[model samples]
Target: MITSPDNDNNRDEPMVFIVIAKAYETEGGQPIDLHVMLTAPDDDTAVRLTLNALSEEGFLEADLDQIGMITGAPDEEPHASAYQGALEGEVAIIRFA
Candidate 1:
């Protein structure tokens, strides 16, 4: 994950990620729940961190909420590799695991 700004001019950009996990009963019954809500310096880092933490804790299934520019597109939805990279950093969630 690139911690600092992409450009020479340092600007602190923030990204948010939400993690949702299901609550279960003793016999493995189901009751869905929003497990955690976290904000990281970037979305890739946030999702990657959340997945790693949950996986280490032995959670099988979870949902990821990626907001802001992290969804790989902006308001206009431009089809450019550089544009996508500019919006979302070059961090892949699976790599953390």
Candidate 2:
């Protein structure tokens, strides 16, 4: 979990963010998808933290840009399958009604 510092008047509670990384195998160019959960104060911070974490783990940023989605509420479980194969590959924060 990564978070900005809390100030006297603002308390930033941790929120769950889903991260999907498109990783390729070193041997045959096979693609392995990764679905992960990250905790942060907000969606933007979540993406930044996720990118940092992935980079530390040796995943390239270009490969990572393939898929990134923030799903579920702070108390809800994320459904990773629902957003698979998304073409746009844009950053999204989705909440159920």
Candidate 3:
């Protein structure tokens, strides 16, 4: 799990978010999905970061139109399972002081 820097003095730092997106491969292929946990000052920043990462990895902007959900920091219990199994990808969490 990648994590952003922590500044104890800053109380207004951005919270982390879990971004889940799914889109069909090509025009009729099977659906592809991604689960990423990232930190940003807000939802918009998180989405932008996710998009940039995806694009860097060859995912087109047109293919990302089918976002399933963008949720704020989830509780620990449910997220614990995400850490298990094979790792798909990882991103450092960003925190602003």
Model number with the top TM-score:
3
Once superposed on the true structure, which residue ranges of model 2 sit more than 4 Å away at CA? Answer: 1-13, 25-28, 62-97
Ranking by lDDT: 3, 2, 1
Provide C-alpha RMSD values for all models, in order: 11.9, 10.9, 10.7
Candidate 2 residue pairs in backbone clash: none
Expressed as tens digits, the lDDT of each residue in 5-77 for candidate 2 is 6577464433445665665435446555666565556667766765666556655542444324344433333
Q: Model 2, residue 46: displacement in angstroms? A: 0.9
Which regions of candidate 1 are displaced past 4 Å? 1-17, 20-31, 65-97
lDDT of candidate 3 vs native? 0.50
Preferred candidate (lDDT higher): 2 or 3: 3
lDDT of 1 by residue, 1-97 (tens): 9886578534455343444445332345454454343445665766667666655655565555434444333344222432344336432222111
Q: Candidate 1, TM-score vs. the true structure?
A: 0.37
TM-score to true structure, per model:
0.37, 0.44, 0.47
How would you encode candidate 3's per-residue C-alpha lDDT over 27-83 as one tens digit per residue?
556556666565556668767877776666655532333322333433464354443
- TM-score order, best first, reads 3, 2, 1
* Error at 77, model 1, angstroms: 37
| Best candidate (score: lDDT) | 3
- What C-alpha lDDT values do all the predictions have? 0.45, 0.48, 0.50
